[model samples]
Target: MSEEIGRVGGPKNVREALLISSETADRNRHEIYEFGPFRLEPAERKLSRGDEVVTLTPKVFDMLVMLVRHSGHLLEKDDLIRSLWPDSFVEEGNLSNNIFVLRKALGNDREYIETVPRRGYRFVGAVRQLPPTGRNAISGVLEGQIRDVPSRQTRRGWKILFAAAAALLLFAAVFILRRFRGENSASSPNSPHLAVEQRLTSNPSDVPVRAAAISADGKYLAYADPTGLYLSQISSGETRRWSLPKDFVVFPRSWYPDGAHLLVVRDPKHPLDSSLPNPSLYKLSILGGEPQKIMSNAWGGSVSPDGSRIAYLSHTNAGDLWIMDSDGANARKVVAGPDPNKGGAGQDLIWRVVWSPTGQHLAYIQAHYRNAPDPVEPISSLRIVDPDGGGASVVLEDARLGPVALWWGREDRILFSYREDPANAQRNYGVYSIRIDGRTGKAIGPPQAVTRAEGFIEGMNGTPDGKRLVLWRLRVPAQVFISDYDPGTRQWKEPRRLVLDANENLAWVWTADSKAVFFVSNRNGTWKLFKQAIDETSPEVLVEGPSISDPRLSADGTQVLYLSSSNPDDASFPAEVMSKPIAGGTPRVVIQGKGIGNFQCAMAPSTLCLFSRDGGDYVFRVFDLEHGAGRELLKLQHQVWSENGSWSLSSDGSKLAIFLDQHRIRFFSIATGAAQDVTVKDWPLQNGDWGANSQTVFMPSHSPAGVPVILEVDQTGKAKVVLQGKPNADFGWMIQSPDSRHAVLGEYIPTDNNAWILNDF
Candidate 1:
């Protein structure tokens, strides 16, 4: 899994790469360094070990001086790349080659150059700075040491240029360190009662903090807002906006061990689900510069404690855990997933892959759906594994434990967010901790609750010192809405919000008379079926459950339909189709199975309801309303690592359109036993439904970056954009009422997220 900026072959040695980097160094070359037996002269661009002179290329000479200058501190691989080839894009192999040559030139002193695994090379031998000589009292460094192309001929201006370069290293270095540590003072030791909570940002509801991370020293905060990316001084509250490229979508994930750079992710449309468009992982300086690309299609990149490697999840690979050198080289799979060779049964997700405090193990959540498309949440376990992929063990396993967020602090203690109440309050998610015995990698005691909140803590990050923590909280709730629609003209207007509350409400099936709407609402703390009339305000509870979802109507429109997982406390409960008369009564089990997916029904005159199961393939069967099961109608090969396809049933029960591939739809005729292919030409297709006329299909889609649009496509594959949606919101499901005058759409309203600091962790 080694990701390189460029994989092309490089010159055999540094001198053969056609790189000349010492223009500024040639003028400001005043510093001389000595380490072990090797002595380096910047003014003369020379190196020697005792009586023997070391032959070095220009770039190799530059690299040696850099390592000696920052002897004890880390020089990130990206930093070295920019310094070595500031104006050009070169394969990472060139840098590796330079180091290899330099190490060989240094001879028997194997201890001189220490490779930091994933990070970069470090000069481990004791280094001393020699007195300034040659009439030059000051030296400077730009991206390590000022660079210029190599020169085969001698410079006539060497004497004058060497003394002309002004001072920068001593003064700029001190000023930068002070500014980075703004009013940063050591706080009293961390204690439970002394825990202090502070709000770092005061943004409005619409303008939210996208993502954030604290500096290694706990003095600076880097965050992204609607306006732009910014860095804020914690103690002084002074914030400055980073000059990012227009329309850049970057979120700071964590800081490097050096405390001068941050690793960030770009175009992360869906952070939790890694099956979407590719996202980028890169590094950028807090002092401001162009981002240096590291890896593509990577997410949740959390650096190890030593900053030598990064643990990230692959996007298209669906939660395959991987670790790569901090330099984006020598990547290895840390955890074996669904064999990439087979890659098709179903994907088990891995997320929040953070390193343990000691850097020996990685803590993450393993989410698996025994029934991959069960509609219910997946079973999640808080687990850890050694960096070498050994000593794997689970710390916490429960039906209530989900994948909201996770973190590791001091003393082998892991803090995570879990659902506290079964069906009482989803918003009451609380933070809990399970202590692991460091030696055995197993839980030491029962889990303990750290804190409870009225809103969900979407994410968590801790300072390097382990004395502070930062949380990103989300409180936005979902609601059902209706809009007047004229499908012929493709116009939507006079929107009306229904069942308004602080809980989530998802639009589903309508009633027999089309006068009321039947939907799923979390108003009572758990998802249950509710029926509300178009003219009424209050909703009447129809199906009370420990939990239920994917509500629909019977073929005859006489019974309400839904799926219930049977047991609330069991993670392996199989979902069963439960039905009750439209007027309401005791629910009866109609069908029982696992891995049930999207299903739909037609009205009275047509008794066609289709049910599907996703596993080895997409199996669609003609289901009876009154009976338990029916015969299989069709099955299609499931595309691995791709979004599951969606289908819509025509009101007349004559046509069924299934959407799965990027551009084609399979339309099946129930009466003729004939199927035709309809292709969408506007853009890659997304979730949609059968149009009222059965001659058109309406699709709600968003761009790779999340700009919403509605498209109307016809049988011939011709299409046109009907309308565009709001900028900040995303669509869930769209359905039209039986009467066709109103349409119901599910929209996840934007949330106001801010960074909160907890001191004395």
Candidate 2:
């Protein structure tokens, strides 16, 4: 079974590696097939209905042959794509277009091609395989039937013999053509194009997939999980843990030409840590033992085509490109991040550096975000350059380009992940490919999507044989649940899901009257704001069309406020902070700004609204309910990560609680400009928010076991666990009503990735 085309050596080897599909190969009985009024000739590559030849395009003809060959059986779309386009992958739309054209040519009166919905297409018509008409069959049938030989034995014998000789010659020619060109044979179900996908592991979110790589021979798979690094037999699914020195976390990155050793990434920090430091590159033997350190603080050292040198990234982001020997010796900088003077956007983020198939050029993705701190409006460019630091040029560049990773595949092709649908990129991330001219090292045409599915294809590695692909899809599946706070018991009631649907959901704050909760969900594909009443089972859609998030009530409690944009990840879109009257009215823009990180508002009569934007550093802005624009409040010069520098407005609109660090919190008085610092006991806090009374703060952190925990910090620096979520769940945010009668908690769901082996993809 062929799987990965990206792993193959060259186009010459690719063409020879793929042959007549098994399904059609074994059925090539040197015969003609017939169905209804149509007669199909395999060796002739022609279809005729009562002598009327049905003209068909080459690709369309190929599609019809496969469907007719596997009549009544579903031909998977992936398999068909592989068969039709053996070298380059295209979007499913291309396959649909071919099918539509084929149907039209086949006279669509009867449902010849049946689409199985999300699956593949099937040919429902009955088919008959007619035996080959040879010289022997013709002589045998007619020789006995013709009793009267026109009263001349010599003439009759000569005619029969001549006919037999011509039939024999024709049969021999047909047999030879079928062997070389595959005639009308379609790819068999077992062909690489139709390779079946197999899941190798069923691990949960806690033991997420670290990394995976397929061997060149397509016989073994090297991967890393929470347990440890493992080597698995592809055919038997027999996986064995590799015994190595403990303490450091490790993940398999790529394979060496020898296949006995693998390039691995070793991180000294704990794998379960929320934030991990940079990892060092290492070379580990599959035979087991200690891994040898290759280079420190580097990435991408996969074996070059000739197994001489490697191109690696000096840093993870905005890093210089460097090439080093195979044994980690004689390392030197080959290329640095894009220059700022040459119309370059600051430092170019170098991602997924790979050596071209022939070791002629090095391919890499240069990317930059409009807002660096928060990574908004990502502009990615696929560029390649000579390893000697010459012949540098951009192959493809797009403002909305966000590929999971890029890989130079077989046949001078590069495979990368990108979203097809711009509106809802969350579920549309798929693998795409583009062919490169071997001589010029330039793209031949626009990129085409090869694989499309839900979740993110975080990692992909194909076998060198171009027959198998290793897929690692990552997903963070979460749902919203309401946990009521009981002042009587000073505890939270058992949480009940806010929305019954299975889609991911998150709640920010309750409605003005506290009778309902406004939350964001991707139930209809894109993230939208919806209000769910506690008394009702269904939620009402409050905002749709544009992507919206962070649903909160205005400080005066008379309006609903949310951040809406065309593309959430893109900071250039300029998110509009909109508000609508709770009693029902068109939403009006309060303020719009590019690179808005997040926004929040205090309870009724407080009029304390704050929004943060991340261009390079974090900047805070404040606005009132009646104001159309906001005034800059505070500008943070220091870089803020996911957790550090978290802030929240107080319910009384008198102060702001901000996390100066993991263990420190600062409360700034709004009017007097007074500040008070308080220290907490939590070792690491993601963020902190002000409570209803404005005197206490809640800090969110995760336990080592991956459970979400919230810490309640008092003015005296004392802390206690207020709310802890279930296992494999995240604590999104915490919100309390102004009355303090009840509280709403956002519990994030488990997130995990699956390792799959797709044959012949």
Candidate 3:
């Protein structure tokens, strides 16, 4: 039977029969059956409830079959359209008309099928077969009835039957017209809370990380959504706004110094136009005004405390830091000739200038790409420099740390962290703080650490005019807290929990007013941006849309920009970043069509590679939530390949390490197009990522014993075993926390249905 089933390319007859019921002739039943308030007899090609006949067309009958067979599953509108008219093209309105007819046949019980917003309909109802009389008795009765009908028609009964038929037709004609009008009214464009939903795996939400950053005052939030940036208000969920121009691909990177404006980055013009510079930084006002371009050739930058100067990393292969005026003038080189002799020409790239709280000094991480002729790790370091390009020094040099993340306090102190390696082939970042200027450098807590674990440290304003400190801690479900400092004790107090169960992560930017946190959450399974008090219940959906990501609230919380997936039903989940108002209105698509399909995001938001317009090619696209467009940057022609293409990135977005050429692992630098081979022994390299510092890359190697091992290496071509063993440990998709303080591994126990996270060890 199994062989027969396989040969026939379908399930066995026994299984098929079991799926249905007995008594009904196998040949009499159609491919699909619908039995509910309305009994549709496909062989008779009629629909009826009890003795009352209901009129329907052949196409509508077929639609009923499709909906019933897959009852309780959301059926995409496109799928239904194809199923009904496989050989012929039909207008969308035709499908709608047929649905109206079907619903009329069902009468007031049309709720059996639910309409999901923006997608399709789902048949949700109870279905059961009718009890049968004795088989022979039923068959004999049906046969006699069939014979009687023919004989009666010959006995001059035509006149009476014709009169009845006329009345039935008249009733049906009026009923159908009314039903059509009713359906149109119900599906009005102005319907509130309407959303298209489908129970399909290939839909949106496949991407794991969806987050946004809110500023100190919490008045605005900045998000890097697949959609465009959005601004929502806390006082009254009344208005929502968008942030973007009509054509440019402008995504929100970070918030401005005052939260009164957003830091928007414009993506490269096009991949073919290599002359087009990388995304430049600009300041977009929350209240809406002309966007002031600050830097034209910078990838990532930050606003100085006074909001007068912008510190950014140049996108050129030379990789230098430059300080520019907020209005896009008076640019000065902050870091000159980083290994000038090397000419900054390699896969390894340095990053942005971070100004100290006092704005007196600047800091950045420098990369020294180690050419791994074989399986070797590269080395990198944290280099501090003056904003005027003076007094340069290397604060920390380590191959494993990757790119450094620096957090500045109001007291002119800089907090930096390093990770031992990328965790679990995914990313398990850890957290630790070191005082800049080579003073009081120590691991904050749980100092007895063998490896770095995942943690986060964000600047939260303290009481008494920003004299105190508030920091945020994030794992899978992120939370916030206030970090109390004791100068005499030289330690941070146990933090106070601010908000719990953040759903996903922050998706909106903080407002300059410091009163609320705006973000998007799918707690209800639909991505919508919201804003709430810092300690209030989580935010609510600010706008109505399908699959929104990368939401950045304008500094004043008046506008929002985000990338929204319009057609989640598409296999590729084709999306266009859109912009709307905080007050909520029609959203305009800023970035039109480009990518061929959806690419799973394995890297952090820093460096993302989506499917390019050209098949088999990938382009670095910055999803501008503010601008509602994804602009292409660097284009690569098949440099890396993956069946699933699951890979990871450096914290600073400089490098990408993925399984290349199938079994062997490879590392590719985003800046220099440098590719190298990594030494992967007995275990095949499945998934991995670069350390926080970007120099070292970690790949998961599973031994013959079925134990997963983390292979670690240094630039000197030295290799060593870091963490190995544990056949049951599924760390293939873990990630190192941003601060490099902790690593989270995916632990799945098949026996007990246990699949959960293991935090910092």
Candidate 4:
């Protein structure tokens, strides 16, 4: 009976054989697989629905592939864990999180994956082998059926085939033509234009335009660079520099509604110092005159639409949002941030407040503390509150790395600038807008992109009419440099560029042998570890993956330690400390936690490494790698804006030198946990590292003329100038060799920025 229905060597046999051969070829090639409407390409490490690609994290993608590979079979939890995290210890919660994210990515077809209570997971969906070239498997069956038809049916089959092919061709042609026309209509030179962009400032010196604001009348622009404040007439292109008190530095924040006066933040001392006392707000007129003080201890301020009230942020232990009368009276805190006594863990800052045009509401940005658990949820957010501080709510959460300028536009829309990926914020920033649902104080619509500029957008402000936007574009290139220090002459030789790359190359440390240096760079889109010999011109890749930071070499010259993360764009992703052999090998997980910062190990006789973790406070821990154990050594009070390299390990690993708040340094004994303050009269140390013999620490200082110089501070709080940086250069992140003969420094080349106006944007 089976032979009568279908005989061997007939058309059906040929088709079956062809399909079997195709399946064999697919398995050999390890190409795409099909389950329902989804196609999984194992070779490409990608999944797709028809022609659209799906995005997934590295681990999540791997888990999905494993499930599909063992379809119809239950995968034990232990088995799955062994397969996914083969080299490291991962908690069960992490596996559950991946499954949850995978289910969400699968959308409506997530039911294909089933769970057995307290057992494991099973992929029950029917999956088929697909051709390596992505051809439809059903099409092959159809072709076989047509060919197997009797002689009399051949003409009809051919006609049907021709008609179907013609239809598909016609549809494809129409789609292509429509797409071409749509693209051309939007950007073609012949298209009717609605707006034009104009360049306002042509700075020949390449000095960055630091802060900028547009006047209410939209006729003038006020900007500050390294030199001083400058006023420019937008229409006539005339510019004039304003004269101010000598040595006084100020940044332009906002303008008065009348357009003739501006609100600025002035710092008589070091402008970059976060703990500067009473950073006062002043009103400077467009015409030359002595500035009038508006309020002390305030920074970013915005005038109300009617100019009756001023909303400003006060710089204190707890950053507070305050509102006062136009003349700086009746100041009251409207939004209170984290309390100083509480360590300001998550609720640290309120940034860049702006009053709405109607004066009924005020909007501002809030910064997320770095030590969060969700990895991506706490970068920054947008909030809207009633001017009286009632009914305050977050309008947008997890808005990527901000301090982004906000402008309330027509139709209740709030426009701001943000980078799509916070990990690459240095290169990408675009303007986006979302409308607010007024009654609920929530975002109404999805964020729509206004412009994706090529360069970085530093600051943005819109005109009163909301027809133009003034913004600064910046491009900075940083390189690594090495200098020779002569202990005999007590001087440093001119620094030579060490690692030459267009991308940022930041120096981390010198090898224990002092023959090569290791650094972290983003030249390949993700920050990775690279090493270069002292005499080499180019660097060789040492470790490549998601993102790496704070590379450190072990004191015994046997291991290299660094902090790494799978999702570098998200701060909530806990950074794990990993170590490998100095000569190179598979990296082994050493420490796993959230907010792991820079680390340092003892140079010679000690096998101890000291690292810091940011929770509510900066906690320092000592890890004994040889014993495979760690213990908390000390904890420092958290400062809102403390530098990452604020602590260093002594050479013998017996003590740690920590820079504390108020320009103070503390020497803590590692053995007894005793602490003593080392007083340096008036020097504000920005960056420092321990010198040879552990008796003195090398700290970078600036001369009165602002030239970079290095000062060696001894245990007795005495310091003297050891090396001075070249004129017109900035030195940061100093790393000294144990022998004290060579030093590696981070030299920041000034980035050129230009101001441009986007008309009708």
lDDT against the true structure, per candidate, is 0.70, 0.68, 0.48, 0.70
Instruction: Write the number of the candidate with greater TM-score, choosing between 1 and 4.
Output: 4
Ranking by TM-score: 4, 1, 2, 3
lDDT per residue as tens, model 2, 195-215: 233466557777778678887
Off by over 4 Å in 3: 1-213, 232-241, 269-277, 337-343, 373-378, 410-413, 420-427, 437-761
Candidate 3 vs candidate 4, lDDT winner: 4
- Clashing residue pairs in candidate 1 are 20-148, 20-149, 20-150, 21-148, 22-148, 23-148, 118-325, 118-326
Model 3's TM-score against the true structure: 0.34
| Each candidate: RMSD | 22.7, 12.4, 28.6, 17.5
- What is the C-alpha lDDT profile of model 1 across 588-663, one tens digit per residue? 9887776666678887688888887765677878877567679988777665223555678887788888775557
Q: Record all residue pairs in model 4 with backbone atoms less than 3 Å apart, i.e. clashing.
A: 375-572, 375-573
For model 3, the local distance difference test gives 0.48
Residue-level lDDT of model 3, residues 311-379, one tens digit each, is 777766446778888787898877654442332344456643456666766667676543111112245
Q: Write down the TM-score of every candidate.
A: 0.70, 0.70, 0.34, 0.71
Candidate 4 structure quality by residue, lDDT tens digits, 51-81: 9998999778877766675454455666567
Kindly indicate the candidate among 2 and 4 with the higher lDDT: 4
Model 4: per-residue Cα lDDT at residue 410: 54
